[model samples]
Target chain A: MLQSIVHVCLAGLSQGMFIWLVASGLTLIFGVLGVLNFAHGSFYMLGAYFCFMVLRALGENFWWGLLLGPVCVAAVGYLVERFFLRRVYGLELPYQLLLTFAFVLLFDDLVKIFWGAASIGTPPAPGLADSIMILGRRFPSYNLFVIAVGPLLALGLWGLLEKTWAGRIIRASSSDREMASALGVKVPTLFTAVFVFGTWLGALGGGLAVPYLGLLTPGMGEQIIIEAFVVAVIGGLGSLKGAFLGALVIGLLSAFGTRFLPTFDMFLTFILMAGVLLWRPQGFFGEAR
Target chain B: MSKKGMNRRQFVKAGLMTAAAAALGPAVLKPTSLWAAESKVKGPIKLGYQTVLSGTLAGYGEFHKMGAIMAMEEINTAGGIAGNKLEIEFRDSTLKAPDAIQNARYFVDSWGADFLAGIDSSGQALALAPVMAELDRVLMVTHAATEKLTEEQVFKNGVKQIFRIVTPTYQDGNAAAFVAKDLPVKTWATINPKYEYGFTCWNMFKETLSALKKDVTFTAESWAPFGTTDFRSHINTIMDAKPEGLYSVEWAGELITMVKQGIQAGLFNQVKHVMFPVGAAMDVLEGLGAEMPDNIWISGRYYFLYPNDKSNNDWVERFHKRWQHYPAYVSEGAYSTMYAFKKAVEAAGSKETKAVVGALEGMTLDSPAGKRVFRKEDHQAMYDVPWGLTVSNPKYPFKIMGKQVMVPAKDCFARPPFEGPGTKPPFKA
Candidate 1:
């Protein structure tokens, strides 16, 4: 029983890490831009597809995909922010929402045209396919790698945000956009940079997740986007720390729920979201407007 | 103000007449015009094909379209159905129930389709089944496999317009049980998508298996929402239960994900037997190629290399020649449905909807899947269910079924004339 509990916890933690990776990006973008960026999930999908294409074309280590997939997605993100998103900065929230949602449909069709409608699978990276014995039971090494990534990324992001001048500028701008611009922070350029970085984070999550999930399908982004949104909301919109916590809560709930209450697994996440909304509308870490 | 100027009462009367005309004009004129135009069935017999043209299930729809296209081309080339050229108008359902119903109506009302066919999801099939009766049109369901469409919805709802070319889920479940009884598996667990088809599949398999093997126990059950991308937690939960065998009803992309993740988690290492009723689909094999493990049991509605008959082999060759990829069951279902429609039309000696429905009730026709008989009682096809073990064959790039087990339709199918456990007479009568 104890071992089973341990297994569930480990599975939950690893799953949470992936959710955190996605939710963090969404939260970050919302925090700085005050736009929901519904296409955040599309970037993640592109990451997976791009990584798969790279791996298929250049037969080498999986590292190639990890290194280049996010870069490609980041470039696309940069262009999207510079051209389309730039126009919507001063518009109503609905326009920004509608514009981002349009990107979702556009990318969905684009993926179908390029990748075809069939799902594609990538083989496990070399040396990561096997399982290792843990707590007298076998656990996938790939999941361990996934679990480790969340904390590593969180620490890196913390350092960048807290210690560096660029991070300081970004923080200042997000908090006081008018003041930052008055102080010569190049507000438009900073917004673009932040959007691109957030997109890269989403893409990185997708690339990292594809090998473990083992299949990539068009509209896969839409499936995960809702869960990511729930996490972002529960953790407090735009709060990176809250996103992590929310992901963990949802992931663990999913894992344990499957064991104890198989029928309500899908509803469990929503129930939590509802509870959070009822109790704390702004979210755990969110600031009042 | 002279003879042209109107009094206040006269002006009010003219305004009311104009408002009435504006409100009722289209409703009265549109249908009459459409009926007048559509009543003349002069040139070709049109079939309205509705299925998922986008999303994860698109492959099934694509294959269905391919198979239907091939059949239409052949028939058109060799003197079309009853001297009239057969053509299909395709519509994307997007795999939603509302969209499928809307598409079905559009096909019948707007395009004047002689018949409606093609549905990838069972839910769509169930939703559209009732609509067929409302439209007073015959709908040949090509791919959706829910037993409820024929067993409950057809008989209980008095829906005679719907007929399924694919084997019902109940029959497949019974076949699965037969295969399970022969194997060395004892304790069984199931992981299926949470939906009508999945639940019905699991229940039928379990009930039939329990009847066959008195000692068999179902240790664990897991239900994942449809189109779920992650199955790690589900996998861990199943592994913890440690069932000797697993039955998974997940199909297409979701199945690919589960199998691959199962391998990574070493779940297969612990479980002795695993069966995927729809896993032998060409798309699944092609997607997983070389990574698909050997000895795992899989079943398909139709396999390209099965029946080992000459005519079946010829059809396979012809399909491969044109499409370059082996046809999945959905493809065969669509192909056979077109031929079935042709046979029924020829038998009835008319393309009228009521006549076609009557002819199709107990029709027996030759298809690529060998001979199929649509039961008069329920309108469900009675055909062989093919199951096999996955083996790496040298001739094919992907894994092919080896040591094939052909479950005879006689043993698997329910008795006819609304005699099944869940079947009932129409409440209206």
Candidate 2:
């Protein structure tokens, strides 16, 4: 029983990490840009498909694909922001949303044309393919990697945001965009950078996720996007710390939900999200105005 | 001598033709041009296939579309059904109920389809089943396998115009149980997608397992929502329980993900036996490719390469040639439904919906899956449900079912009499 709990925790952590990657990106973009990039999940999907194609053409070293996949995705993200998202700045939220939605369809069809309408597999990393002994039972090492990386990345992100000059510029602009512009900051460059950075986070999540989930089919982005939104909402839309917390809670809930509540497993995540929203409208960390 | 002989032969032939024409007189003079002038080309019959075409279960919808196209082309080449040609118009359901219902309306109202068919998700079927009753048109269901369309949940008076080509969930679940019992597995873990059909499969599989092996124990049960990309936790739970066998009712996207993740995590190596519902999805098999281990006990709605018979081979070969991929169960379902509709239409000799419905209630149609007859009692189509051990074939890209066994639909299925006149039928599980 102890062993099972430990295994479940590992599973939860892996799932939590995936959610964190996307939610963090969503949070950062929403915080700094004040624009909800609805197409954030599409970037994640591109990373995954990119990894699949590269690994298929190359070999099954998920780590190599994981490392290299994000570069191209980041480049695409930069282009998408420069060309498409730049127009939507200072515009209504719905316009930004609609444009992103169109992007969702565009990327979805592009994947279909390139990959065809079939599921493709991604093998687990070579060394991490084997399960590790934990709490007197075996658990997958790939999952352990995910568990360790989530918090490490969180700390790294924190250091980047709090301790660096570039981070200070981002924090200043997000807090008061008009004030940052008055202070002679390169406001437009900051916004573009934030959007591109958010997109990079999404792609990084997707690339890291490939080896564990192991298949890239069309519309997979849409499915994960909903869950990421739930995490973002529960964690407070623009709070990176809240995104991490929300991901953790959502992950554990999803993992244990399937085990204990078997029948209601499908609704558990949404039910939890609803409960959280009812209790805390601004999420766990957001200030009640 | 050779040149002179050839010249003599040519002259003799010309002389003979002139003599024969002269002897035949006016009869031979009749215009050979009349027959050539009378030849006329007819237009193709357009069929609108509305289905879940681009989501997690998109493969099923696409398979059905391909099957319909294959059947239409094959039939058209053989002079078509009653001298009319066939074409198909497709719409994507996105695996949503409202989308499917909307597509149904569009197919009938806007597309003006001669025939309409499709559905991969049973939820979509339940959503659109009422449209069949409302519209005075025949909607041949090819892939949606939920029993509700044919049995208990079917709208009052809806059964008349609706015909099912795919075996319902319970029927397919029963076959999985039957095959599992033959193995050494005695304890089981149930992991199915968290949905109506998945729940239905769990209940039916458990019930069937109980009946087959009364002493068998169920150790754990897990349900993941449709399109669940991660199965690590579910696998951990099931593995912890240490069930002798595992029953996974996941299909298409979820099934492929689970198999790849579960195998990598070493669940297959630990479990004594494994059986996945819809284990025959080509997307799952093709996705897994060489990584899918051999000898996992699995069953699906259709296996294109199963039958050794000539007719089955011919159809399979033709379908493969046309589609460039193995026909998943959805394609088989669509192909079978179209043929059933064709037979019904011919028998009724009218495009009138009621007449076709009457003909279909007790119809038996020859399909690529062999002879399948709809049971008049429940409107559930009956045919051989093939279950097999998954084996990787060097000749093919994906794992194909080998050591196959066909359990005749009648042998495994019991179309219990409908709970008549207001008493609710027992909800499965």
Q: Model 2, range B170-252, lDDT digits (tens) per residue? A: 55577777777777888888777777888887777877778777788888888786678888878887887889899887877
Residue B136 in candidate 2 has what lDDT?
44
Which stretches in model 2 have alpha-carbon errors above 4 Å? A263-268, A287-289, B1-44, B153-158, B416-429
In model 2 chain B, where is the ten-residue run with the lowest total lDDT? Answer: B420-429
Per-residue accuracy of model 2 over A1-289 as CA lDDT, tens digit each: 7777777777877898899998899888998888887788899999888876666666766767777787788889889889988898878887898899899988888887887766667677778878776766666787788888889989999999999999999999988989999999999888888887888889888888787777777777887788889999999988899999999998988888776666676688888888888999999876565
Q: Is the docking of candidate 1 incorrect, acceptable, medium or high quality?
A: medium
lDDT by residue (B1-429, candidate 1, tens digit) is 443465556556645654564477568656544554335334589999988887667777778888999999999999888778999999998888978977886787668788989888888998887678767678888878887788777766779999988877854587888899999888999889898888988988988888778899998888888877778778877888889999998999999988888887778888979899998888999989988888889988888887789999999999999998788888999999889988988777777766777889889989888889988878888888689999998998889888777768767765545564533211111
Tens digit per residue, CA lDDT, model 1, A186-242: 999989999999999999998997787887888888877888999999999989989
Backbone atom clashes (below 3 Å) for every candidate: 0, 2
The per-residue C-alpha lDDT of model 1 at residue A41 equals: 91
Clashes of 1: 0
Per-residue error (Å), model 1, residue A137: 2.5
Q: Each prediction's Cα lDDT score?
A: 0.84, 0.76
